[model samples]
Target: MISHSSTAHPMPNSVVNLYVYDQSIAGVAKMPLDDFATAFGVPKESINLNSPELRRYFLNHIQIITEAKPWQTHIESVRVINSNDPIVREYQELLLNFICTPVKRTSTRDFTFKYDAIIHQVITHKIMVNVVQDWQGGILGSQVQVGEIALNIPKGQYFPLVVKLQNGSWWKGFGSMVSLGMYHIAEGADHLLFLLVLLLPCMLVPNGQNWGAFASASFGIKHMVKLVTAFTLGHSITLFVGAFQWIRLPQQWVEVWIALSIMISSIHAYRPLFAKKEGWIALGFGFVHGMAFASILMDIRLSAGALAWSILGFNLGIECMQILLLTVVLPLILWLSKRSEYILFRKVVSAISFLIACFWMLERIFFFKQL
Candidate 1:
């Protein structure tokens, strides 16, 4: 089987995957085992499935032609995968990763595939071709069949299969990223909890060692705007830089820090921890949260232009969600600030946020350790 997708490399290329059955593919390359073992021995539990010879064989057989020129093909990696049938039995498949680069930069969208790897020698074998990811075409995390490559029994020849993908545009990819960012924040309960908990005490002043009376609405609004803006600025910086890989952090540590940020905000909500300096604190923690956001972008394959658009779109989506949340909750929070029971309510919420953050931190720590 063969599949195509856009690559994550800086240079534009098409990522093609070739899946060959282990038993069937053994005929294409020499085995490390002896001749007797290769001919009569039972299958070992583990063995090397790919080699230089096999890679060269693949490069010689598979060709992607576009604009009437053959695209350069190279083997990226090879690995064994368990593709067992739940109802039937267990078996393994060899997955060969191929990187096909266009001779001209403008011809990445359409191509003709000419693959004769195992099929060249094993006429009975057929290759299924599919499109697994096409960002511009709005295909992500799903497979759509293109066509198959097989020998014409009557003609006794293999025909080249021309793949015509849906024309992709920059706007479609950018819009999808925006939706992705919005969904990410909407689902990330911990991120929302951190921001909300920090906002809880915005309307209250710090008098002596405790939270004082309700501050004026204008004062609260000014403070909130500063805090939120500081946060946005913080995350945006790291989001841009981190996505480009200028700075990198371990995902587990980022998660741990995010949980820690929530805990700090929750404690500050309960009492005056950093009272008037909440904006700075938000900015600092925002950097940590931004690191977590960058992790999402790192998984996607994009050219430089696509990456830039994705970052902008994703950040806009995040801001939109944050504004929507604040719109719904800000007035309610302000109203509650004037009530006598507001102090108790704040403590309850603060306590809950702190506990939730603690749970998240521990869960991430233990989970990562196990891995």
Candidate 2:
């Protein structure tokens, strides 16, 4: 039984459902009553899920169901059953209803009253609470431990804790937040393609219709820095607002637009569309990308001080990754821009990137499930 002097609570009150299972002490073992009394001197279920000062009585039991014992009896009654038949429905219910035990209890010491203040804020909708019990083959102890848990969330299981956000200091999980940003940016193929394709032409001078070597490396570097900074600023704005729940956008639309951005830039490599205004394009399309980034944080339900720190960490990670990628690729692009063969490599890569962007655009629009 749970001790009254115990300081730790089993679980936080945010938990919507609680499950209690009673294990068989004997389990069909040839053991004496004294041994059972000594092993489990006090029944763990005696305290129940709440206070233990109640006079209400509860039963500890298990039921067995087998194909020969149940199906044989149920199958014998069926004769030319149809979809709409009453007997068919009854038989179906019996077959599906494998619940061996039902929970029925009433007590004056209401445990839920502890969360009455915040329950309305969290549980905005009705939830059906069903009870079930099962039998085990081995010796079961008096202690209870949490088993498997399945959450209806994407990426990971986010525990919804009922925290006093007004007074409590936010958790410092900067590394985790940074990792989230790095992983997302790395996996965002369309986003990276759009940025890289635009950057490829940064060093080359646009002469009316054709591309040639830069006037100076400094000039190329200057423009590159400006474009990257602009892109960073554009996304930062929406990421903050979206995390705070001040704005929202559909994910599918954002992904489709992102793919479209990549396609346009890839096409521009073959034919100059934006020319010297790549910075402007990066800033403009960046808002859409920022919204996509915000959706990740919002889905996990981050807020306030924690939200602030996480955003900082995430953005910092993005910048670090961006810088790292540019450091490696920018020099290579500059070296190759002066070569005659580089143009061939550029066009080939651009064509492949455009095709990939096309595929992504179609997939996002059609809601194709990627395996």
- Residue 33 in model 1: shift from native, Å? 18
Clashing pairs in model 1?
Answer: none
Residue 85 deviation, candidate 2, in Å? 32
lDDT of 1 by residue, 13-90 (tens): 112332211011111111122221222232434444464655666688778787788878777676654544333235
Candidate number with greatest TM-score? 1
Candidate 2 per-residue C-alpha lDDT over 1-371 given as tens digits, one digit per residue, 9 for 90 to 100: 22223323222211112222221111110111222222324343342222222111101111221222211101111111112222222211110111122123221111121111122222221111211111111101223322112232474332222111111122324665676688778887777887888787787777777666655688888888988888899899888988888987777787788898889888887667888887888787778788888877664433376567778878887888788889988888778877888778788888998999999999888875422
Off by over 4 Å in 2: 1-171, 368-371
Give per-model TM-scores: 0.76, 0.56
Give the clash total for candidate 1.
0
